[model samples]
Target: MTRNLFLANRIREVLLNGKWIANTNFKEQIINVNWEKAVQKIGNINSIAMLTFHINYYLDGLLKAFVNGKLEINDRFSFDLQPITSAEDWNNLVKDFISNAEKFANAVLALDNSRLDEIFIDEKYDTYLRNIEGVIEHSYYHLGQVVLIKKMFDLQ
Candidate 1:
């Protein structure tokens, strides 16, 4: 398989299933969480719902960059999550997150391997490979936070 495909697979594994580094993936972690607990806050920590939005927020931005050849996301407002008022709202967010992740992974897989070395829009930031890999790493980082937040809810 090409390097781009390999990276896409890694992203899929972390977001969906079959993760080698951890037993739980992003989907599994949030699949059974109820709306009440999803919006619960443990001290000043971000709620599960907010973290889900935050994770997908960057994925959406990266996907845009992949399709348009430019990145336009504002880092400061990336975590501005909408309020979750109902189960349907939370479920929809999860659904959108999964859908976007799948689309992002497929988009990456379809790219030419040589493109991975090319600078992503701006020459100052990094290559496409670096940015793509950064998204996966970023997801895993937030996934850890989600897990801990869930554990905290369970304890309480």
Candidate 2:
């Protein structure tokens, strides 16, 4: 398979579906979680809702960059999740996340293999392939956290 397809598949594996790595994806973990459980704070670690928003924040920004040819996202603002006090709010976030995950994967698949070597946003940020790989790695890192946190909740 092409590099683009491989990258996109990695994105889908972590975010939407494909359990080859983690045995669970973001959709599988967060889709069934209700508002209360999502927002539940365990110690100081991020809530499930916060992690979801954080990942989707990058997905939305990076997906836009893929289309608009510009990268504009701030890590400081990544966790700035608005209050998810209602089931409707939580559901809306999950819905947007799922939509953006698919769109981001499609954007990666559409990328030319040559573009992977091109700088992403700027030289300091490194190549497109690096950023894409970072997304996949970063996602799996947080997905593990989500899984552990959820298990902790189940125990309590």
Candidate 3:
């Protein structure tokens, strides 16, 4: 009913749906994908795993910052996930994907609506927002791409 209540609900909804996409879209595979077959260079570009890891890598950092409030990480854009060379490893990453997202959702739940406008320095963006809305949106957009890539590889 109040403004704070409304923002809290919005953050909650976005987080829940976003976590769902991460878990639901990820694929389990043994014998890691060859960086070659994993991605298609439609002229010049990286692989699907790279893009997916790009998203997940950001998730790891953003979520940690949002929840823990510690904004320091070395691999800013490194999406290299150490080559998922086994089914178990892939599964673990998927589990981590879900777990970390849920952790973020809980962090959102813990935030006060008043703090939404609290500015935390994002060295990359150089701007801030009231809540984690922008970060969540970023993850969701990439999660969609991850879904598309997974389907493409799985179906192939």
Candidate 4:
């Protein structure tokens, strides 16, 4: 029928769905998140703490761009929020991560189907109806890792 219900909207669903699963993936009780333990490396994979912030960072960046009609890329070339090197910082980052996700969903819902495919016509991304879906894919890919990483770390 319409792109909103079919294509673009499906992408937005991925983004929102990632947020839902991620929130559940990192439970303090389930994972036993110790400040030192979280940072420990079991090879070269990113820590769960890093994945948590990274997922949110991308959500914020993409949603912020959608709201402003522009794509913003930080020099670090990462999707996650600021790194969590400490106990307090991790807590705050996670809170902001959840809040940003809620905001991102609202922005997507506010957009019409045409705008989704309106062809950004801007230097950044230079694509149409993909900003939301792109972010959704990014979110899902990382969220899956978050789940796997959680399992990896807990086995210790």
The best candidate by lDDT is: 2
Let me know the TM-score candidate 1 reaches against the reference structure.
0.96
State every prediction's TM-score relative to the real structure.
0.96, 0.98, 0.62, 0.71
- Candidate 2 local lDDT, 1-156, one digit each (tens): 999999999999999997999999999999999899999999999999999999999999998887787878999999999998899999999999999999989999999999999999889989999999999999999999999999999899
Native RMSD of candidate 2 (Å): 0.7
Candidate 2 backbone overlaps, count: 0
Tens digit of per-residue lDDT, candidate 4, span 33-129: 6655555567988876677667666767777677676667573766344555787776676667666766766666666867776676474665556
Off by over 4 Å in 2: none
lDDT of 3 by residue, 28-103 (tens): 2212444454544333444555655665566577666765667755565466667765556555655565566566
Each model's C-alpha lDDT?
Answer: 0.88, 0.94, 0.53, 0.61
Which candidate number has the best TM-score?
Answer: 2
Better of 1 and 3 by TM-score: 1
Q: In model 3, which runs have C-alpha deviations exceeding 4 angstroms?
A: 1-52, 122-131, 154-156
Full candidate order by TM-score, most accurate first: 2, 1, 4, 3
What overall lDDT, based on C-alpha atoms, would model 1 receive against the true structure? 0.88
In every candidate, how many clashes are there? 0, 0, 2, 1
TM-score of decoy 2: 0.98
Location of the lowest summed lDDT over 10 successive residues in candidate 4 = 23-32
Order the candidates by lDDT, highest first: 2, 1, 4, 3
